[model samples]
Target: MNEHILLVNPWIYDFTAYDLWMKPLGLLYLASHLKNSGYKVTLLDCMDRHYPFMPLPDHPGPKRLKSVGCGSYYREKIPKPAQFLSIPRYWSRFGIPWDEVKKQLKEIEPPGWVFITGTMTYWYPGQVAFLNLVRQLWGKTQVIIGGWYPTLCSEHAHQWGFDRIIEGIDPLLVIKQLSSDFKELSTITGYKEFFSVKPAFDLYKKLDYTVVLTSIGCPFRCTYCASGRYFSEFWRRPWEQVLDEITYDYENYRIQDLAFYDDALLYRAEESFLPLLKALQKERLPLRFHLPNSIHARYVTREIAELMRECNFETLRISLEFSDVDSQKNTGNKVDNFIFEKAIQSFIQAGYAPEELEVYLLFGLPGLKAKDYELSIEYVTDLGLKPRLSLFSPLPGTPDFEKVIMHQIKDDPLFQNKIAYLYLSEQNELYEALQRKISKYTFFH
Candidate 1:
């Protein structure tokens, strides 16, 4: 029997969305597992900006490509959800058209099961739309939904029309569940073969860039972050396996850019990162790495910084979540001013330009004042480092979520959108002022 499974990366229905070399990595990993289990797998990326089937008018052209693999998405302004009607900005469905999605589904043979991956809780509208479409086409086919959204808001995910919902980040948990349900478990000869299975990146039509997760979960328990909640365990993968994955993509696909999705890239660097960097340097590949997730400032030792420079670390971001002592203590004390200073100095001494080293300053906390953000920006600018503001989104299962009033959320996941929901007057004023101030000091290096 030909047991085929359809994997879907749903669209982003929001006020704004961007492709920071984003991919449904979990779904791709699942695809590889299914393929190994003797089931045919197909991926339908609804948010594929490069999909040629649905082309936009040449008059406007597609949103201009920015940087090597990061750029804007094809956005179509849609009516805002009833709850977000008061918000001024236009709501958009950021992805290919609905007709194109249906067309792609029709091209493939009907599968026995449709596996859909969910991202942010606020983006549930996209998942709902995807599930509705899947039902229309394959009435009796099983629909299994999983990922961050279902894991964080399992109760809420039930309303999305999924036949079954799986939570947590364990790939083995998923495999075991499927095997028990289907009664056709693939024979696992040994642990070596299991860990050797790579993500099915070949499923994509064209690969612009890929994401890597060398380490799972995070060591620090930040109040605002749900990293610990999602994984609940901190573990690093084998460096040899990581190296093989990177080289495979580089040699086979000619991929130049790789985005690291690790929550703690620099945690215990001597054990994981140090060896990985040394190996990459030995290979002398012309590939550039991007750390989209900020690293621990304290972990940025002089030696690590020097090694990163040698390996062509194109984008380096360190987390300086807050400046004040109270705020720093409240949210995990990942980096203090003293530690941050040393890390910045190390990068600069290692020949990294100011623009190349961006420090992330968090904003939009419940009790945080605008002055806190202003002082932090001033400190980062004074030290000649670029400031990248990461607005806070109150995710369920985070420490900060308990501090706020859940009644205000009203069970609407849309309230989880930081841009649309966290619109405090003071934060808004500070954000705008900082944007204007930083615009004058813009330098590319």
Candidate 2:
């Protein structure tokens, strides 16, 4: 008999988290590969907003989901972790209740192995919690954990007791490692052999949106980013495969919202994104697309913007880390005034509403003054786009980690919590002053 495998996308424990077209693309890809190789795959998405067992909370209705399918997550309040006791905000687990998760696990038969995926480095507590529950229910069933958190903070993950941990996006290597260790568990399936298989979206109880990756890794190496560390090499899949995945989701699954999780989607657009967009236009499927992971501003030319609009791009976000050109160059020449202005104008001319486009402004970098972020926010707002403040989480592998350590911010465990002003010194009043300025500016409302 073929092996039964369980794949889980763990919850996010944070001060604030939204669905924002998020999905475990990597884990689902593995599930698809395993299923195609004759394994019975079961997916447990803890972040499923439409989970049927939970009672609906008294909250606002769903946000304006575009015709293509991107929307929000159902949220509930939970106690903040002990480390964040100093922070005066309610930190919640952004997913289903613990009881519901346990109940679902109880219903499943003993599997050969369980695969778990992680996200933000600071959100490892969620992964730990999920693993603990799995241990409780399955009693020594081998669990494998991988993704951004494990790949970046492998040392920390070892303490969490996962039987095996794989890093990076090399699915073939991971399968080999799993096969060698758990030969009795299942038959080995190489990545090339499973290339044609689609992700097991059918295992999901509710399909809000589907995530697709046309490429992996990024060409540029930014000091503050972990993209290079996670992917290590840039590789683009065939355009036809991308189109087929989109079409399959639209036609067969009735999935309208598709999010591209590529770190570099727009780079070399003539060869990469353009062909895919043209193919999509030719098909004229009534579907909407999103780039939740910010795209490269340097490549967003007017032609690309028009093509994106023609291909039904519903939501897009561009990374505008700093308004100061010198600061931006110091971090990485990821954006320049020329590129920024052109990208903004191209999207505007391409018929995207100002509100539909957002510019992510990184807040709380070491040595950055409160006035600097204030100016950055104002600059993005002046560009006729929403300024979304992405609080900087100091990952272990990023250049910022040494800076953070030198500053002794990590000395206090509370500093590891991303939501807190980690870069600010305990005696520094800059954080409170910046918070006041942000509140006074009031643009997102």
Q: What is the lDDT of residue 251 in candidate 2?
A: 78
Give residue 25's error in model 1 in angstroms: 1.3
The reply for model 2, stretches above 4 Å from the true place, is 65-78, 182-195, 405-415, 421-445
| Tens-place lDDT digits, model 1, residues 183-240 | 5544533234445678899988788888887887788888999886555466788888
Worst 10 residues of 2 by lDDT: 405-414
The collision pairs in model 2 are 68-257
* Tens digit per residue, CA lDDT, model 2, 1-445: 5878889888888776766777777677778766666788888888877778755544543557533454445556787766567766777777888778888888889887888887776677778888888888888688988776676666767877898888665655566666665453244454334356688787876786888887766888888887766544667777888898888888777877788888899887787689899888889998878887899989888888988999888778899888998889888799987789889899889988877887888876777777788788788777766777776767666787667643434443235556664423342255556656555555445
Predicted model with the maximum lDDT: 1
Residue 409 lDDT in candidate 2: 40
The Cα error of candidate 1 at residue 108, in Å, is: 1.7
Each prediction's TM-score versus the true structure: 0.93, 0.89
Question: Which residue runs does candidate 1 get wrong by more than 4 Å?
Answer: 56-65, 182-194, 424-427, 441-445
